[model samples]
Target: MTARRPTAIDIVEVGPRDGLQNDSRHLSTEAKVEMIAKLAGAGLRRIEAASFVNPKRVPQMADAEAVLARVVDLPGVSVSGLVLNGRGFERALAAGLREISFVAVATDTMAARNQGTTARGLVETWAGIAKRAEAEGLFRSVTIAVAFGCPFEGEVPLARVIEIARALAESGADEISLADTIGVATPLAVEERFAALSEAVPGLPMRAHFHNTRNTGYANADAALRSGVTVLDASLGGLGGCPFAPGATGNIATEDLVSMLERDRVATGVSLELLRDATLWLEGEMGRRLPAHGAHVSPWPRVLAA
Candidate 1:
């Protein structure tokens, strides 16, 4: 008997935030607003629109509040922002964002490099953030970066990843995301790790975030879906990388992921043609070709002429 695939999946569009944060060129607040509006028009319901980070650190996201102010009224879209600390979380709340994603690195070395804190320290901070989010009636998601492998520390043990995830869960995180910050995971490894995570936190909503540095991102995404992950994080035009994780590439393309899921008979509630158009616009704005496969190929003709 053939395995049954999920009838539907949620693709969280992280292009406006994750995709643009690492780019050298800074997009204006207006440009950010336009990009997000186009993405929502393409039927993307969940979008990570901005990050409340220090401007000196990530200038691309310096206008998080402005971007959110412009696109918060877009119909049928749930906008979320990334927050790293209490200050960032407060910024997101002030911007009227309903959902927030908090990131914590799996290894102490990465945590120090990314956020200037140790893993334990970040977890402690996250506990407080979680309490505040709950008090304010905000949704919170905890993303464990470098869950598969860390650039500074080479390979991260499964035990360590699970331990961190468990800690975050105990801290009142409503959702969990495992991120392959350096994109070094194999299909089997993704399956095994997600399976382990599922066993550790049964029934918890889990997400998978991957980079395509080594070209295993799509495979890992497939493994993640098969392992019962309900949400997959992707970027438009495959436009992002980690500023800290050297050699890391953009995420799995949103258009490509949606195409694959649609072809596999899974529902993603996204329009491929609209996604393609958005990618083309982004390519033109960036003045270069993007890495997304859907951006390069023409859509197949629905009806062939005899």
Candidate 2:
């Protein structure tokens, strides 16, 4: 263990949006809201509940307005939605989303594939979004996708990532997240990238989004904690992948992340017993066994104490 680490952390539940976006079986708007209510009942205060994008592009996220309309009133919970462009941001604003998360990819090819724009172009879009969203009193956040490694571009330079983080901070972003879009991040790399991002963007709150594509999501989460990151993103039941990024799958499960963090004595303000119960319900909704470990096994004593 390090000589010092954060005594508490914030875990953003991304299951309702990121977890279901790529699943083969589409959940109805009612089902999506139900899942969000369950997550809220489980003590998740920050939930990425919906994505505002074109239905033709992401059919699973078709009824973004409908989903948000139902779950935004979860008591003591702040619901957010993902937005990629100006139109998506407008939709999120109009749909009553208090927090809007925008994604910026690292490589040009990935940017083109995931967002239909280059990396530089996305930053330009963000500048405009920051101005309007701030005026509207919305909490603005940006996620740097494929920050570790890109499927098409292979290795994403740390220098480029730092530059992007600096730009986002300068453009009025309230917080920034470095996403391991393809799950190639190791523990060492996780620490290094976060350290650099912290150095680059100093006081801007930094978040991490990791995939278990190579089974290192949990380890990377530990590394991020060690590196002094207070916010981490995970999905329920470990279900997630980018539709445009080939072979990418599995976000760190909320049950697993909360269990590990609480075991380390870091207060996440989430109840693992409640998270486990929600994951089980998610598995039933997905109509198959999920890839999460904590939900399938017996809860440890510490998990129950959470």
- Which of the numbered candidates is closest to the native, going by highest TM-score? 1
- Pick by lDDT: which candidate is best? 1
Tens digit of per-residue lDDT, candidate 2, span 106-181: 8889888777789989988899999999999999989999999988999999999988888877889988999998
| Clashing residue pairs, backbone N/CA/C < 3 A, model 1 | none
lDDT on C-alpha atoms for all candidate structures: 0.89, 0.88
C-alpha TM-score for every candidate: 0.97, 0.96
Error of 1 at 197 (Å): 0.6
- Relative to the true structure, candidate 2 reaches a TM of 0.96
